[model samples]
Target: MYVMTLTKSDFEAFKELIKVTLEEQTETFLATKEDIKHLPTKDEFYSKMDEIMGELKATREEVVMFSDLNRKVNDHDERIEKIENNCVILFLFT
Candidate 1:
């Protein structure tokens, strides 16, 4: 279990990085012409495609990590609320 401690500024920076990486990837893909005859061999194109796919997968995993962190934070808050409620009940009963 890894604990992530990110401030609002950290998240903003992450968001910008993801945005820039995605935009650059999109530009690279678009610059590739559809005319295979003028382009690299099928094998070379496939290799490049695989590399881009790997990058996309890594970016997706980063997003998922952020999402998981958010879920864990919510879980911690809920647990705290439950504990507070339990304390209130105990006080009333005593």
Candidate 2:
């Protein structure tokens, strides 16, 4: 388990960067398909396809990580709210 502390601005920046990387990878894969004839050999095309698949897997892992981080942050926020409410009630009774 990993804990990540991020401000709103930082999270937005991180999301933007991830979005751009995914878009670039998608474009590269599409462009490669169009240029496959220049690959010169069957083995070369297969190798390039393997490389693209690896990139896609990595990008997917990044997306999953981002989602997990978002969930954890939301959970933390909820816990903080509960604590704050309890504190307010305690002060009112005292």
Backbone clashes under 3 angstroms, per model: 0, 0
Query: Could you tell me every candidate's TM-score relative to the true structure?
Result: 0.41, 0.55
Candidate 2 Cα RMSD after full superposition onto the native fold (Å)? 30.2
- Point out where model 1 deviates above 4 Å: 1-38, 84-94
Clashing pairs in 1: none
Tens-digit per-residue lDDT, 44-74, candidate 2: 7799999999999999999999999999999
Candidate 1 global TM-score: 0.41
lDDT of model 1, residue 57: 100
Candidate 1, 17-60: lDDT as tens digits: 99999999987777445644587888999999999999999999
What is the C-alpha local distance difference test score of candidate 1?
Answer: 0.93
True-structure Cα RMSD, model 1: 28.4
